[model samples]
Target: MEQKVFIKYFSGTMSRGTRGIVFLLAIALLAICAQNTQARVTLENGVKSKVYLSPKIALHQGSVANKYYYDMEFPKGHIAIKSFNAEVVDEEGNPVSLKETYLHHWVAARYYQRKGIKEPKHYGNLGFQQSDHIPAGNAGVCNSASGLSQFFGLGSETRKTSTHVPDPYGIEVGNPLEIPSGYEEKWLLNVHAIDTRGVVDAMGCTECRCSLYNVTVDEYGQPFKPNYAGGLYCCYDETQCKVKNGLESVKRNVYMKYTVTWVDWSESIIPVKIYIFDVTDSWQYTGIHDCLIEFDVEQSTTNECMDTRRSKSSFPIAGDVVYGVAHLHSGGIGSALYGEDGRVICSSRAIYGEGNEAGDESGYIVGMTTCYPKPGSIKIANGEVLTLESNYSSQKSHIGVMGLFYILVAESSTTLGSPVQIHQESKVPIFFWGVAAFGLAIFAAIVVAYRRRRQNGDGYHSIAT
Candidate 1:
């Protein structure tokens, strides 16, 4: 006869109170771990993981007169770029635009990568201050709201998911667009002319002060030796800037350049993507007028002459916001992001240069540094309304000003949830503790109920049996 085998069964179920306690503690532990994790997630091995790209070029006066090109040449290797950015600067190294130079057109195109892809085509537009259907790749000279005319250059910031202030000129990377090996890429710059001399002459006010004329530049797009004026005036009047005056000077020898930043893959690292948010999409912006507007907030005056209107637009994606910066012309105060519920997610303050330095003229703004505070992560649901708000000085109207904000967004790997008030308070830990306490309370209630039933005699004893 065949030998028989016996097996034991675990029929006892865990008490509801025990289950609740375990679940709560697990959640609390997971939530804490999420905070320590990085914004990027995962990288492959055997590849050059310690990769970063710092491509920079100088735009001389003669070269930028029409369209100048930078044929990006990389050394022999298996290289790729995950992010790219560009900026323009003056000869003095301060963030500034050439007096008459308004970037007419700019394109970063790639040579054919695959056989069927046709001739070299533009992968992105790196022009100054454009928020069209196409993504923005250019980080114009000294993107700030303080109205300081200078180049603050580029800087790198720590990657974070919390809601903190951002530096506009800070060297930050955006969504990854790779330029694989054997593929050629180039940047083209095209600028037009706006005559400040004519604008001042049309004003015909010997006593009237204008920014465009006060900050004067020579035919070579070089500023005068002594620029006593508070601002750079490229045109004498608004009409000259518009309508494309044939008399305006286009041939100016000025210095401009583009700065590109990205992460090089040499080691394993978490991967993140970038997304853009623009305020020009709203009805408030009319292509009929310049992308930059001048406005007087104190007088509440808004017209073609004064741009007292606030720029507001919706954020496109629903993810944890990792990094961000605001792009504004002179006379800006700060930029903020608001939720559909009217809650402010993160506010980036604009920093201005001071002490009457070359770039930091008295009250003029030179740079706007960004912030990346820890613990406070901001998350928005898909299709949620995230408005970009830029505030500027209202004492006087400004011209050729801009208000654009860009951010990096990442997908969360866990459901630990997002944290709020990290800038002011560390709420993640507190939140976990609170959840755990609630779970403990439930467990206690169950225990008390069971004990009461057990002490109740006949019916309780029968149930137990």
Candidate 2:
């Protein structure tokens, strides 16, 4: 009835040309509204983002807080994670400088707990080896026994590093089909931070030097080998590093502020398997994938002062590498991964900061370059041997240094061609084109109506003259 009323008024009072222009304008308006609705739906279907803070950590001058919290708050339900970024923050939500509190590392791992079982209060350094808890670690390369099985992790470089999983690909988690019966999925967060304020040797503390920490035993109360000097074993929870004399100890609280971006799981989202390669892996000779988490680089006697380490491991399965990044300590120069045929798969270099701010603390590694190769451009054949090389400066002795390469691989069976792929490849959104078309239609209608009116006025003026 409203349409009839609008047509009756326009048909009686408007010229045919004006009526046609009005109809075009109305159609354009409807098109814009439809586009707006579709854009909202697209965002709803695409990705969701949220920021969360972990439980508060208490620390005094030169103290270390390396605690693991089970069942941390994470996005619940089945989803494909696109990215995870984190940083240290004080109580007022302000960014904390790395110069003050050194973020040794933060690791996020997945696990499954029995439906009716309650987890224990203490989860000692042994990890989730209990019967009721099942650790769901990364895809492979490092054995679970090595404790480098986290799905996501970073140290001081966490602030500037890019962990985004590109379009059509994501780190899949929490799928109902993958969960065992009577067990539910949960996330575990391990934050290892060192309070370096007023410390005698800031660099030594961050490097976990045993002399500065004054410890001759590991976290498990086991005696350290004679050659073991500095590493994670020396700076376990509650351990203290050397602090300046007469500096009153002041306690403060801090938290790990992290942001997570993910999308609801769907058939179109291709799953990527995470593989972390360590330069210290001794799988070739030992016939066991024993990965020494950290190693020291002694100062060279010769002039070169460059320590180079390499390891070779076979790819478990054939797949396309979607993303790659390297994890290196402060003294690391750079690292790279080479295929069996000597092709460079990825090379990541540590980015050192030169400022005194939080993310740009001078002399600290703020970030590492990342790799997002074109889909299918970098492929790993089944059982292909790959070489990893990590370089560090040996001008000064460095302890607890690590060289880890993290990569995301998608199986060959997952096709890259999809409707989502086209959308992702486009630099601009479809709704923007719709908006431009709508604006053009309005402008065209106004010009057409103005010319018609001008023509009618000219005809009347000629008659009057």
Candidate 2 pairs with clashing backbones: none
**Best-matching candidate per TM-score:** 2
Candidate 2 regions exceeding 4 Å error are 1-45, 419-465
Model 1: ten consecutive residues of lowest lDDT? 152-161
Q: Give per-residue CA lDDT, model 1, range 52-141, as digits (tens).
A: 122333332212223223234322232224333333344444444323233322224222232233433442222323321122233311
User: What lDDT is reached at residue 320 by model 2?
Assistant: 98
Q: Please provide the root mean square deviation of candidate 1 (C-alpha atoms, Å).
A: 22.6
- What TM-score would you give candidate 1 relative to the actual structure? 0.43
- Candidate 1 local Cα displacement, residue 288, angstroms: 18
Residue 103 deviation, candidate 2, in Å?
0.7
